[model samples]
Target: MDYASLKQKLQAFERQLDATLAALPSRQWASSSALRIASELYEIGAFKNSGTDRAEYLDYGYAILASHFVAGEVGYQADISREADLRQLIADLSFASHYYMIREYLYYSYNVPESMSWSFGEGRVEIRFSDKSIPRQFFTVYNDQMLGSQSHFRNFNHSAEIIRLLENEPEGVVTPNFETADPLMRAEADLKLAAYFSLIAPDSQIDLGGYSYAQFLNVYRMLLTKALYHRYLARAQDAVGAIYMPEGQLLDGIAGELGISLDIGRRILKDLVFDLDAAANRVDATYFSLMREGEPGGRIVMRPHHFATAEGLVNMLRVIAQRRPQTFLDRVSNEIGRAFVQRVKAAWEAEGFTCLSEVSLRDFDPKLPDIDLLVISCEPTLGYIIHVCELKCPVPPRWAKDQLKVLNKDSVSKAFRQVEVLQRFLRTEAGVQFLARVLPKEGHPHFRDFVVALNHLIITSDNAGMFFGAETTRAINFRTLERLLSRSDGDMALIQHILSTYDEHADEALVTTMVEFQLGSLTVAYEGVTASPLLEFPQGSWRSSPDRQAMVDAFIADGAHPFDVLELHPPDVVVNDHSIRVTADEEVPKK
Candidate 1:
């Protein structure tokens, strides 16, 4: 369907939905007693097989209505009270709208709730049907409009079926209504179901006993939204293994088919992941809290947010489908790079290599950046080999060509600078801890003293010929790695040779990139070293004048001096030689 038609249809659907809302008997639905009774009917329908009698069918209707009333109540309330940011609120509404419309369509297309029963004689006696229509019709129609005609079967199907059944039956005989079946009795039954569902609902706040139908509706809508997103995600995921395109392409196609915008689709996907992160933190917190209290299970009611993140991933294929193939490729470069790393890791492991991915330097020093992948291969001839791979996913080939040489040059410069920073960080105490974290199992015991040869690798989708190679940071095309993997079985020599070339072509200064700032005149404790209070230098700066260092050394050694010399040199303020300032408070205490 064209976008215009799909939009128009959507608008029509919304109008129908509003009518459905207006049709609801709020006075009855909002009644506490009525909600309670409806809940009881739902429980009965859930656990028991009430035969196809009028009373049984009525019970089913009560269950369906009660479920909606409670859902609407919970969802509406949660939505109003949701403490999400503006973006989150927008996402929530989008999902809720999608969910609501889908549900409404399903209800109409399949004649649900209403289809569950056929009332003969205009509500005198209701008869049940196990199969009047299929819910799958809605799924097929939504994804492909031509597959099924949209129709509001409503009570029409039930009425027709009842008419047919009655016409076929003996004229004198009729479906009998249970003697005790009445609105009040059904209400009572519904209340009992409501109470039962309250006890069993995963979320306590959603329990009908304490919360109204409106509030419950809010939560219910969110849950349904999450569920629908998940449904699409699962379907798209199944396509990923079979499709040649990037994962996002598949998701995009699904979204387009569903008439959902790529932007909205992506937002849903992102929100899903964020929600999962939140859920994970909550679970961890719960686990720790319970452990502290010496408790078990925690019996936590999995919140809707916990499930939202997961369902959010369903948007991947639909959202990604909207991008140009090149854009999709560029965005997924990390995924491709990681895949290459995994393959390399596995190949090396088979050939005796240890590899680690996503090594963070922040563990030792909270300020340092992280390494993407670190592969360590021990050779019988060579001592220890550590390969640090930093990936730069280039722009789309077309864009790169159009943008000219400046982009390429900038990329090369940026990459070399990163290498310098990484080399500097590695020489610090933090780098020592980082090495410990990535050390191979066999090398763990001797990691502290292991003599290591480090090789830096820059993996990028860009061709290796695009920029000049650095001594420590050598660019390797992603395709080259793939080809090498395909050709070589387990040859350490081939890999070592490639890296040796990188080492040979690398600048000599890369080896000495890690430097220590030597304070020549300063005497420091082995375990504790502090700079002179008067001197200020940038973090990680190693440059120091020899004369200043000598003066510091003299100051440290002058124990026989009767007085101390204190100077103030703020970072931005420089102190001149032969200058002394004495405050009134420091004039020998006026003695």
Candidate 2:
């Protein structure tokens, strides 16, 4: 449409979009945090350090056009250094997408309708309001938590720190706005839970139809505990993936997420916090270059791993070691060299065998060093090393050649004839046969009896399908087996029976049954809320703390994005967004 026409249409649409948005269900916005993002551009205005250029105006061009984006990806950038313009662009987007939740939850109310959705340009959000928008059954659950007043929206003092901090952003940002938005934490969960009160969730009987709120909360948390990030579990249900989640697919050219805690990643027993399909779509979209990338003046030079090549992996590992000194402590969160050690160990363990996450090929002639995935299965007759295989997640990293040289120079395959890596190695009968050289990597970890120890140490498994062109093998490491058995398989699915549940991290928390003791008993008017009947959550959930943490971190003053921590209600702490969006004030004074 022409500017005048486009302007006219969008303006009318804006009014409608706003009113309609105010009327839609929380599930809709919760469904695609990116969908409602248009409202920010069309109504609230996004940021761009690039002055007033179309390139910048259109920075969020992709998001404006695309229907949704992964929640975590809202601040995506290709680099973080020397891109004030791009950083501002990110600041603008964050402010608008999470600006402020008018309703946040499906609190029963009169003005609110059954459900609604709004689209500005190609983007749109379909919110399902609480059924009938009745005042009591469900929507009224959190009226006390709604934004204090609409006047709060009048003169939006968008955080300068937020604007300054977002000036230069890099690609694949992974931050959650938790550290800065603390006081308003409960508000965060409210925004997401808003959809629950909306009308999307089916009116099911098992939502403890006649149970007390306390009783219903218990079952609710239990269902959520069972599904969040339960990929194998998700495989069984027809739910959609989350928009903001990182999936099984590896990413290229991205920085580690900001403000996220171990709890944010490891604490999720289930992702039943929001709509499954929308969640899936949001997360699945993370496989591309979205938003303002390579604009003039505003350049972002990302860490090597963000680009995802063999060399990039090496460099990222190096950076990780330089930056995170304590990574050596944990198998899962270790950085760089140690991370690689952990990775190799984990990969080898995926195959069948009793092995440590780390191995020393010194025990055997050929050491399988500097490899991505190693698979092997053992049979007493065939020998201790029955089968051997190696695999890698190929993302076409930029530094592939340099790292390759470092690897080939040492070439464990050469030193130890039996050792092998990649396509050439696994194709051979010896590869299929698996029993190659040995290494001296046993009992490195301080702890004992992890899945890494039980299943992978004994055997190697491969599903060549994991890569573009490869053979067929899938190992049964204790961890992998546990994951498999935890969820429903195709055959057993129809039976509605399960042998056991598989916890992703397999941490003490799951065993502790932390969720069961919390909101397990609370009840809600399932007919009124938009939550999925497929799962449930506890009434007084311990997760509430973290869930609140996730929200409060993002909710800014007057619904504006907190570009930096200095601009927050309580400053002096952190000043970076997920993709490393640091503020000038947070930077050391220039010499």
Candidate 1 lDDT over residue span 1-591, tens digit each: 444554454455446545544454432233222333332322333223353222223332332232232222321222223334222333322233233324433343232233222222321322232221212111211222111111112212232223233332332232332111222223432332332212122332322222322333333333334232222222323210100123255346535544445655444433222122323333211111000101121111222212222211112221232222454454443444455456545644654467777777765666655776787765332235577777654431211122123134455446666777877666554454455445564542312222345667776543353324223455655544544433344344566565445322322212111111111222111111111111111122111224544554564465422122222211111111112322212232211
Runs off by more than 4 Å, candidate 2: 1-61, 64-353, 356-467, 470-482, 485-591
lDDT for 381 (candidate 2): 16
Task: List per-prediction Cα lDDT, in the order shown.
Answer: 0.35, 0.26
Top candidate on TM-score is 1
Q: Write the residue-wise lDDT of candidate 2 on 1-591 in tens digits.
A: 234453454345335434532332221333233333332322212212233332223323323223332233333333223355334434444322321222222211112222222223333322333222221112221121122112223343333333233333322242343223222322322332332211112222221112222222333322222222122112223222222223211111111322223333221212212122324444211222212111222111111111111121222223222333254123212222343334445533543333433343433226345333343332111112222323221221112121122123332112222232323433333432222223223421221111111011111111111111111223222223223322222122211111122111111111110011011121111112222111111122222245644554445323532232223333112221212322222352211
Q: How far is candidate 1 from the true structure (C-alpha RMSD, Å)?
A: 30.9
Q: Write down the worst ten-residue block by lDDT for model 1.
A: 286-295
Local error of candidate 1 at 53, Å? 79
RMSD of each: 30.9, 28.7
